[model samples]
Target: MRIPKLASVFLLMACLVAYLTYVKWHIEGIKPALFKVPYQHSGTESDDDKQTSPDLSSDRFQYGIMFDAGSTGTRIHIFKFLLEENEPPKLSHETFKAIKPGLSAYADDPDKCREGIEELMEVAKGTVPESLWNSTPLVLKATAGLRLLPGEKATQLLDKVREVFEESPFLAKGDSVSIMDGTDEGISAWITVNFLIGELNDSDGATVGMLDLGGGSTQITFSPQDKTIQTSPIDYITSLQMFNRTHTLYSHSYLGLGLMSARLAILGGVEGQPLGGSQELVSPCLSPDFEDRWEHAEVVYTVKGQKAGEPVYESCYNKVEKVLYRKVKKAEEAKEMNFYASSYYYDRAVDIGAIDENIGGVIKVNDYSEAAKKVCNSIVETPQEHPFLCLDLTYISVLLQELGFPKDNVLKLARQINHVETSWALGATFHYIESLSRQQMTEHTGKEDKMAALSAQ
Candidate 1:
């Protein structure tokens, strides 16, 4: 809303002042290149995990809504920020909710995606106060799952979401609903890790690397040590600007190298194309005579194992090697960085008692190998709780080695840092809000100048 002449100048000044305050809150973290998920949810909780709200007034707070549309499921994050202070904004309260059968599930029936999208919106409406609904930005970012779909199908799905977003009370930008680029995904994940670790606030502190294993893709990102950098591919290096400082990060996302996709490949089944009929997919990765059913990318396959003979770990390793060999680029620099691995890495580590679910733990590269050997050995004697456990452990060990991490090198794995869950969404929120602020300033300048001239006359 604009006021007459003199008032417009004051409004412009106000916008400028507001933008300056937000800069100290946002620029300390991620920049927009600048960048997807499993659905996990809980009720409203403060920074202390209690139901109590801060003493801040409603007008003094800002909120952001992010929908992580992943292959396996969809999740919504409603975040509230305390913005009245001159210092960096504190994440005061958050509400999260998730639903299965991601948007990609309705590829053929795109419009059917409405029910789920609207359901998530209901959560946002309840979490974000109505007064701030129009000010809060709503965004949905699809990841590898959507990218793997046919061009026309992906476009259709995104269009369907755009329609829902348009009707919501929250602010929606032109690119609000779309498939996120893989490279940006890695960079954003890297930002999430550093931000959570407080590395972004300390200009001179060393930051960490990030390893994210999703159902459709995997990403690796970090700031490489100058001398440790090798002849990496040109596309693997990208420059990021934060706090007005340039950071050249080693980053990449392998579309098909994710744990789920790799498992599907190891089982000898194609992604969209299932075995034409009753043909069962067989592999040495499973226990001898082991028979089971598994579903991937909406296709169900009958999978089993080879006859028991050689050591189970060795047999599984052979299969895992073929799936990963020469596929992952080795980064010598990753070994020197303190890497934080999450997603399936954290899940599998918990499954094997290597890490506690709540606190997580540290492990050397060989820890995977040891876990794989132990698990694989027992699976041969009896039916294991998780049939894919052997293959997963073996695959992770080999994949790490392929990426140039030696057996002795250590990595810290976690699902969260402090009380808040670790995720790329936090980093992305800052980027989105900052972009929105810049757009407003640009639009404000011309209008303000025109009004100032009219006032003088």
Candidate 2:
């Protein structure tokens, strides 16, 4: 009794060491990012609606998590249903926090890459509301940056993320982290914008087309009916995809477009032989219509000071306009030369050639005023091919018919409803859930499996 056994003492010391190590690691893993209060900005359900009750059993969830891993950063958005019964969750109520430890951080080692994802997950989890801690679904998806990374790094990183976050009871258990395809990411981007514009419709009577132009690739989707794509509680339009036609909406990512466009427009057409340099003064065509173009350019403007003085002109274009003007002149020349050299490029130069041959080149010639009237009429009356896709909505409408959406109702919805570009995480999660439920059904014979049992009935 006076002395304990040496073996027992050794075992006790090992246990103490293990406990301390776990505590240290856990504390170190805590992320500092804070979650903003998830509050509804519009269309929130009213708590006082006594007739309506929160249907926790509904297969559809209003609250979930989306992780967007892009080239420059990782953003985790928490979408929560802040409304009470009888109220629909406002899509705008979603809140997010982003970390800049990009996918390139893991360019060398899978372990480091895994750490980046884990860090984001930790930060996201820590910031969400305590009430949603257990019920919120987490959808994880990576962008081209992550997916395009070669070697075992991408797969290993995914496995490690699954190992770390899958253990959390808060995450929907039994499902792995979602991995997105290029098409899914494109769809989500469109979805986000479409939802922002309040254009998602709930019906099978309409269809829509969506287009998403990303940094590396472009995504185009066509939905035929509103609910054919998924068995989601919401009445979402559905359609097949048109992977072959990337140009239906005329989106050309071309690897360097975003950066090159900015650089050329800002720096005067690269060095050595242009307007910014000597011996290059050819008096490029500076259009008098430049102001009109500027007004239409997509740019974020800034006001130097509130008026009291003459309007402080601080358009972002002002910084690069002159340089861009020269570049545009050069571009026109380049295009002409390129066209002159390549017969294929010049074939479609005229509108008559671009029109479908089936239409027999019915080029409707009209006077200026008549042309304006027709253009406006077409813009207003054209039927949508998909209702949910709003990005480049006009272009999407054309794509929808090409993608096999129904002609009348489908096109109308596509025109009227906004589109949400796809999310890799959400789509992957959905596919995974579908697969999982299928597996569970196959494995279970009893009534305890809720999803399977319901299906069986």
Candidate 3:
């Protein structure tokens, strides 16, 4: 049947709109064509992303939200731009808010999903920049905690989170909720950290290795050059597959190193070891109440000697902070302590009992010496590498020599990493501008344009 070209075009447009509406309401939260798909950029932006983006300069938003869901807590970094006359771009203004209700808190309670967003908002109270209050572009995201939700649960949780975002009062016109899984979380962290530390080698390079230590799980990503790993369970949009031509990246999420795991590991190991018979030689790090088990109350104890186990538990207001400082001060000794000994081996002083100045008497040190000694020995025999290492400009030069990478290639990699660092701050600004441009088009014409106008002032 002969049909007018206008009529046929109209029919096609109607079909397209119907499909889009169906996608938006019934299937996924948003259409892949209109929104960034989950895991789509798992390794890096796809060909379509590159093809669609035309303008990469001059954005409109002033503030950006960078959410980092760590092992013990979830941190939200709010950043704002400051315009200066003929000045180089920089992350001039920023703030951070964190919530301790980590992934474990929402493991069973689906309602707790919104807690992540709420916590960030509550903490930002008066701190939110005045400019961002009405039109700020909030980038909502998740990390290790929600990365591994089972099956459709992640989708439902993400949907619920989106629903909360729509209902949230803090949301601005262009605010968005992007739920991410382990791969994306780990990669983004790697990218963000290296960008901050000046490690990304180049604008077109690709590198991947991650060791992320989260609360319940550790995510390890090994994105080989020109290859992608299929570990992420979420659709492509939720994954953070980074693809660059000239950068170096490695990341991993180790689950057991968080505060909770570390404490448990220490406690369990200490339980098996027997204390020594020494009195007044107690370890200074342990508290007198080390042996007590109260489900809800704080444990208290005192260490007995100098360099000996002191009443560390009783002296500190919080056990975590005390342990953190102790850990850093003792980090050099980490290689000597095994996972088992890490629980109780503060020092040999703990083997000796503490002195009771009030009673003029010496206390006995119940030494778990043998067990601690065993664990310490293991640490020495097997050293743990840094969770992830950066192949910075200098590192790349050295690594290339060791691997016999052509001198030319070495120089190229070095140059790329240097360039990325130089442009790191601007890259983020460009990304934000691009996002704003797309949103404006969608709002006005119902046409989602991938290209965004971004420029530096």
Candidate 4:
């Protein structure tokens, strides 16, 4: 009751300072600690660690898995992408694994296909973080091999793959597993090559064409300088819209024109047809003295070379011409376009030392023809190490010419571009992501419209 006024005022000011200090500690320190506790218990990193660590959210790395089901093999591609807002995603890493004998081999026993699919799924599961398992998309696109199978059998195998996909944690849309149309196969491959080379999105960038040879089909796709729709067959032209631009590409896939299928055809063996009892397929394309058993589509055929008469190249050329002549429509526009030939095209070129396996190289259409003649002529004198080499080389030579590549027209043979396999899977994945984004945008716009209408009301 007898306290001085100055001392009382000092005590009051000191209490106010203490109250403000407590409030600051609660708001800036204790609240952050409480929020951070959950992240620590959730087993994620602390806030400080997250700030320093690699960003794993929407703005950074994402992944997609694609399965390529071909006639000879099933391959899985686990692609890791670096995403930036308003920019195209960049492929950072790719994990590719392949299992042999293809999914089509299990057509009769559809249940057996599950093991291979599950094995490939494990690769995807390992590549993508567990946190993103539910969000990552998984897709399988079967090509000519499955397309050639009986409808009932192909359906059974696809159904089993769908079941396996459903059991996995990844996002599996209803249309994720299906047979890819041959035209789409060509277009997807074109997208992959052009995208990898940075031409797909660039308005002024020059685009190269693609030639992909699989086991049961071969595809040629290119954008013509002159609109092909005016002169080319309507069936050969495909219009694709990408990156806000429409590309009228001359794209076609030749069924039964692939190396293996062509071999059977050249040998006069019909696809899906069994030979007469104990009969052998004799062909001039083989070495005169050679005889062996060849296996295709789970059936064994006795194959032998015909007796030597004229020069090997001359006779072999005649037989190969029968398979190529008038069988594939020639694209006059392809004569002017640069093409990147891959898949079996690369394999065959590398086999005969026409191109380097690692660095890749370019060769003229006549290079194949010359190589064929050399191989064919030599096989008769000295038995060839590979019986099919002569035939394969001849087929490729004649096939290119039939497709309208002149003798001097050059083609680039490569197995990979920018450390990624030159295949359609990458392009298909890009298409899938774009489709998803477009769908999400449409839904978002619809929602916004509804909200705006309500506000106006």
Candidate 5:
């Protein structure tokens, strides 16, 4: 084959070019498929979430952002999670920031609420890595504060928040910004506390109960061993699934029973309805000599103490009783379960020095009684910033009794568990992320393609 050396060289060159092209195609196409065979993950997690989690061999990290729109404040919770095979997602880190005067405060001017929402978005952007922004679920669940607003005003406020969320880089759905049912709020908070306390890992173990008192409403949630526990009002019982197990919880949220709302009730003020001109709210809960204007949900009312020498504690207790009687269903099972109290429950306990600021302590139901009695009888000569302390403690005392806690029943109060804030935000975050995973499954499934083809016919 020593014909022309130039012809032989050309022949060799053509063969080499063909082999390189074949190699390129094999590496780009077939090699990927070798490693891409659908990997099966082991777990009892619903099939919808089976593929939502990243591979354990890789970075294996996820993030969730939740905004707790409560009556008193708007808080942003940025959470980082580490995914593991066949186990629950672990919360590795959390970033929390709160701004006062919730969205309802801007009911008259919804546009002004954008500034606070944007500021919180900045915090979220800074906390989460840029690459994960688009994948992270962003949600805002407004609680009792928004629920207390007029229908038109609530819609307007929610619309404003939705506009802001859509503009951000994070993942948000159509229902991202909305009012959360009070019972769901209690259930989410119950999930958070139980998960933080390591109770969710054991299916047979009794999960601790949750008591959350916010500015606009209060929630009580617990899981009783006996299935026959009757939750009067029928709607108070709810079933929630977490980590593949279903929990039957007796949870209720009293709309006007929240600390701030209760203060309004105890002072004889109506919710969402402003007091008319020159109308005054007088109560024995306040100091006999004190007079002031109190503002709640953007409405200001003239509030003051009752006349001097009227048994302050007794009168306050009777008034609180009126507000609570027949309003809250008594849960007899709370006496047997360990419970954790959060929100205003923690704040009031701290105010009275019943629990240390740094290390929260356990207190009996009567502790609130003792503190309320003392706060009511004495007058603080200084600038009484929280004149409602007496009313709050007393209402808590009566509320506990109405909820079936004996005077001597001890309850644990904490603002955080294991360095994580003991609020519904975390539990809600995990739940939201799982929902996103389910949505993704529905979107990417081969069945969708089949359905599209069938519809075309």
Candidate 6:
């Protein structure tokens, strides 16, 4: 307890040295270890990855809902997108559901359409996150089904849909629900295929064509070679600009040439004109032994085959020829371009074993013709469960031939690309985002210009 002064001073110096060392270690090592976040680097992160990676404070998933109201049914497409600040949005997931008897069925009783639209919106509600319900865009685009209806009746149904959209929590902007022009329908489909295949932004990419066969209309769209555009009819040529590239495409949507509509015409039943009660329409395309009632666009018809006569294929071809002859404009350019056919084309091919239902395959125009001939010839010996199979096959064959596709021309039949249904909805969603982005950019530029002028003053 009674230490010398020098010894006590040395003990104090030693204690002071220990304290400084601890402070230095804490500042240079322990504090940094406590506060710094360790990054596990697997590889270099891409610009896209960096942009789309979700911020801990903000969710980056965007949702869009689109309804396709065709002649046969109404379908809902709920798409989930991963959005980046300065990059094109990526489609991360999609939910698709459909209900029968299209919106056109409720044309006369417009009020009845609400239930169907509401049913679809419920699906959207379940698919998207509840927090994003107010920000998700909801849109409905009607095709030829409504286009063929009486203008007033179509308007009434559209107005009813609009009211339903307004009541929903999702964003419903002007033009949210409307009849899509046939040309727009074609272009949208074209966009879907091109975008899904990653060809939109490629300067040297070989873009594929699209063929969509709906109940009431068929669309063909593709970017033709420069010479093809030069020789094509001005009416068949459409200009599309995407990703800052201008594409002059051979795109057209033929009304009344769709499988169902063509069937009506081939059977000699006029659209919108019912043959009153009990009067039957006869066609050679059907099995002579077959007779049934077929319904379309809310109209029922007594349909049957003509009494046995010439060969089934010959007669059926003649009937189908009458339906398509000189009606659909042929795009000579399409013959050389590779095309992807979907909708009824895919369905019919699947029905006949021409393509796989899940993984579609390639088919030639001749394959359809041969299948048609076989189906027509066998109709008499063994009736098909679906009597219209013969007629449908024959019609598809003749339709392709008439459209300038040679018998040898190959078509890829696909119901989906990258697990997403091959249709116009995806394309429509992309277009909507592009439009919004452009508008925002324009506004931002205007604000910048204003600020600059104010600063100068």
* Winning candidate number (TM-score): 4
> Which parts of model 3 are misplaced by more than 4 Å?
1-61, 67-72, 82-89, 103-116, 122-125, 147-160, 169-179, 199-210, 215-457
Per-residue lDDT, model 4, residue 178, is: 95
Candidate structures ordered by TM-score, highest first: 4, 1, 6, 5, 2, 3
Q: What TM-score does each of the candidates earn? A: 0.83, 0.41, 0.39, 0.84, 0.80, 0.81
- TM-score, cand. 3 vs. native: 0.39
Q: What's the true lDDT of residue 57 in model 6?
A: 32
Alpha carbon lDDT at 327, candidate 4: 84
C-alpha positional error of residue 209 in candidate 4 after TM-score superposition, expressed in Å:
0.4
1-457, model 2: which lDDT tens digit per residue?
5366887777776765675565545433221111122324312234532124444432224356667767677777655433323222333244456788766466666566666666666755665555666655666667656655664777676666677667664555544454466555544444433333433322222223443434434344433222333332232233321111111111112222222233323322332223332322111112111111111012222111111222111122233344323321111111111000001111111221323422212121112113222332232234423211111222222222232232232111111112222333333333333344344444442333454344445
Candidate 2 global TM-score: 0.41
lDDT of each: 0.79, 0.37, 0.36, 0.80, 0.79, 0.80
lDDT of 1 by residue, 1-457 (tens): 4457779888877866676566545543222221001122357643544324445457666788999998878999887766543344446556888999888888999999999999999999878889999999999999867887899999999998999999999999898887888777878878777866778656788999988887768888989866545577878888865533567899889888888889999888777777888748887778887898887776788898888888888888888888887889988877777898888988988998888989999878898899999989888788888989999999989988888789998888887776567778776776677667556655655565665576557
Candidate 1 worst ten-residue window by lDDT? 30-39
Clashing pairs in 4: none
Clash list (residue pairs), candidate 1? 35-184
Clash statistics: count for each candidate = 1, 39, 90, 0, 0, 0
Question: What are the runs in model 5 whose C-alpha is more than 4 Å off?
Answer: 1-59, 71-73, 99-101, 227-231, 380-386, 438-457
Between prediction 1 and prediction 6, which has the larger lDDT?
6
What's model 5's lDDT at 369? Answer: 94
